[model samples]
Target: MPSMKNSSFYPSYFLLVGIPGLEHEHIWISIPFCITYAFALFGNLMVMFVILVSPRLHQPMFIFLSMLAGNDGLLCTSFTPKILSVFWFNDRAISFTGCLLQMFFIHSFTSIESGFLLSMAYDRYIAIYNPLRYSSIITSRLILRLVIVFLVRAVVLVGPCLILIKRFPAFKTNIIRHSYCEHMAVVKLADADTHVNSILGLLVAFTILGVDLLLILLSYTMIFNAVFRLPSARLKTFNTCTPHICVFLSFYGMALFSFLSHRYGKKIPPSIHIIFSDIYLLVPPMLNPLIYGIKTSLIREEMGKILWKH
Candidate 1:
């Protein structure tokens, strides 16, 4: 535990330890990581391409789905390349500016994804509860507006956290224990008082993610109530929700586990923390498209057609 107060110069680079206690297993560990990365990239890209070309997918649900796919691709791209390099090539030295850029995009995209999930939940609620007005209520134009708003909110909220990091002109250490440049990981390296940064990070997480999760739950509750009222609609509504519910559980389950482990599991092994951290970021992007492809008949049909045509 050292302070940067006495250091004459700030660090220009930060080193990422791929997995602190499991360096010997990097190659083996990377096999699954690389495979998942490939799957996620290919799957998400296919989702976007299929949705773009298929006129049958020109609805709010599919439109939001395409957005999710695109976001997932970008989100995975932000960290996976660097992570793979760390594992395969031992290229762990990241420039300060580059680290900041990675941190910003990772958190921003995370917030945007949370918001998008909320939007999707809202879409489902409307489709189930207000079928007649669903089209008017959740139009393409409105989706565009919602995307813009989500993006703006993410950038605006995360900008201050980045600024706070920049304000800390010195760091006690340049080596990050985790594989990626996460906000808290970097902030903990700073030599200055990081209370503001920590508080802001928690505030943003609670305000954005907490609120989104609550709203999503509320929407689903309403949808369930409506569905139960009409026994004939129960099966159809459940079918429609299957894929979404799967994606939602997978995305948020890992997220919550990772967050809690990072904050409270100090006695846990470093490798376990690192593994869960990587999984949280990588799994959703990798699995989301696959889940939708298998569970949503429309996407599965489109994928089948593409393969058959080829």
Candidate 2:
């Protein structure tokens, strides 16, 4: 067995390595990581700014986009700073309680993101298919309720993993491979049977991603059916839904890659998993807003106006 670093059964802190097998490249890796984090922050903020300031973008579709952008910002901000610190400064030690908090935030935000994506799909359905009727139906109260419901659902689903992990008596090591406190990675350090931990983590992940994906697909199916029946509306609908489709693919694609790589890709290199995990954390936040900015003309125009004003 490997030598442990902490005092008793519980470790005071867990040490994070930026990436396994890529320690020598930490400096170089930090370059792109920092750039991507900056862009993600800037882009999400820009999306929110555009949506909030532009009267033309006050519709449900853009409202949902702005909400999604805000969640993306929260999601990435929750974990990326720790990673950059580990890479650039070698400050990798995170307290046991801190680790649990990080895990909870990461998982909860991810689940909320999944919920928001589904919400966006529904918003698209309503906006495209029943825009006039929803003009009076979609209220700020309803939007706030959606956000609160997802937050509660995320907390309920992910909060227990930490509770269950706390019952772990001992660990073989205090070191974790990934830079952030991933539930599975941390659970893997435990010396006891972690089947419950693994099961719960996977279950929560698949439940959020799988169910959300299915519902989004169903929503889009209804959307496309409605869009296709109208000959003139087909092109406009496709153009409008293009960004949503792209974002859905990119976000869920990166998620599945990370989740599947973590669980089933034992034969793959550890560094590859770590890299993809980092990308999974970074890419959607970084790219989602870009996708919308490029695809949605209203956002782009408003963004240009804001930049010019600044």
Candidate 3:
């Protein structure tokens, strides 16, 4: 499409190819996607609900849990429905503005979720290393401030990428080979040189994921130091950090693989890339509630009451 005088020419809609070679197998494909999406959707909602209703669970960790759930809800919903529609109903027409909105929500929520994870790690550190001052340090006011900072950072980082997309004077193709309007995928379609957009993207991603992972590691290092020095009851204390560790691994482990695979794993299959990306987005939300419910005794007890304590 030709550029309209001063503004970029965004096509009316972009066609998404959901799982390049699995078009005919979409029915079989939808099964796992549906199941994962179900858990990701309802499980997080249940986590938030249980946290909200249970007063004993009113603490910094659970507060972060609920916030992470909500952000996961945003992150997953940003594009999964559209991806499924492209598969199930062949409804692949996403408007230009809508695609940009999807991209913004997905990226921003992802960054926000990383921030929450870092906060949760800090909460764990406080709860463990300085139990005497945990309540004082991880107060509601601190949580509110942390949330504000994360939201501002996400908007400031991702908003510019979207604006840069709008500045693209033309597009080489209106068809995105993948499901969502991923930043690089969308930028690659622009007719102009988008190296600045691309470079900024890598910088932003490293700033969010890279920094968060490093700080999380540092927090856990301090946590382990504090845990081992305990005179006794070390096993139980170590167990407390298990759920968070599992959640952290599930998210960053898959995320690292997917990011690396997409960027450097050229010899790997495309299906692997697609499936891996989908799993990280969908699986973490599904697993988080279950991990916490099983590992955290307080939450487990309260959840049992909510479900079976009639």
Q: Which candidate tops TM-score?
A: 1
TM-score of each: 0.96, 0.94, 0.95
lDDT of 1 at 85: 95
Q: How close is candidate 1 to the true structure, as a TM-score?
A: 0.96
Residue 291 error, candidate 1, Å: 0.9
Residue 92 C-alpha lDDT in model 3: 77
Q: Model 2 lDDT vs. the true structure?
A: 0.87
What C-alpha lDDT does candidate 3 achieve relative to the native structure? 0.87
Task: Give the lDDT of residue 21 in candidate 1.
Answer: 85
Residue pairs whose backbone atoms clash in candidate 3? none
Predicted candidate 1 versus true structure: per-residue lDDT over 1-310, tens digit per residue: 2323345357878889889989989999999999999999999999999999889988889999999999999999999999999999989989889999999899988999898889988988888888889888998789989999999999999999988888897888888889999999889988888999999999999888888888988998988888888668556766878788888888888988988998899999988988998899899999999889989999889878988999
Among residues 3 or more apart in sequence or in different chains, the pairs in candidate 2 whose N, CA or C atoms overlap within 3 Å are: none
RMSD in Å for all candidates: 2.3, 2.2, 3.0
Backbone Cα, N, C clashes tallied per candidate: 0, 0, 0
- Candidate 2 residue spans exceeding 4 A from truth: 1-8
Which lDDT tens digits does candidate 3 get at residues 1-310?
2222343455777777777777798778888988888888898898899999999988788899999989988788888888888878988778899999999998898899899999989998888787788888999999999999999999999999999999888987787767788888889888899989989999999999999999999999998888878656654756778898999999999889989999999998777788788887888888988898899999888888998966
Ten-residue segment with the worst summed lDDT in candidate 3?
Answer: 1-10
lDDT, candidate 2, 1-310, per-residue tens: 2436555467888889879888989989999989999999999998998899899999877888988999899989999899988888888888899999999998888899999999888877877777677666677888889999999989988988999889899887899888799888898888789998888887887788889999999999988888887667555756788898999999899988888887799999999998998898788899999899998988888888988998
Query: Where is the poorest 10-residue window by lDDT in model 2?
Result: 1-10
Pick the lDDT winner. 1
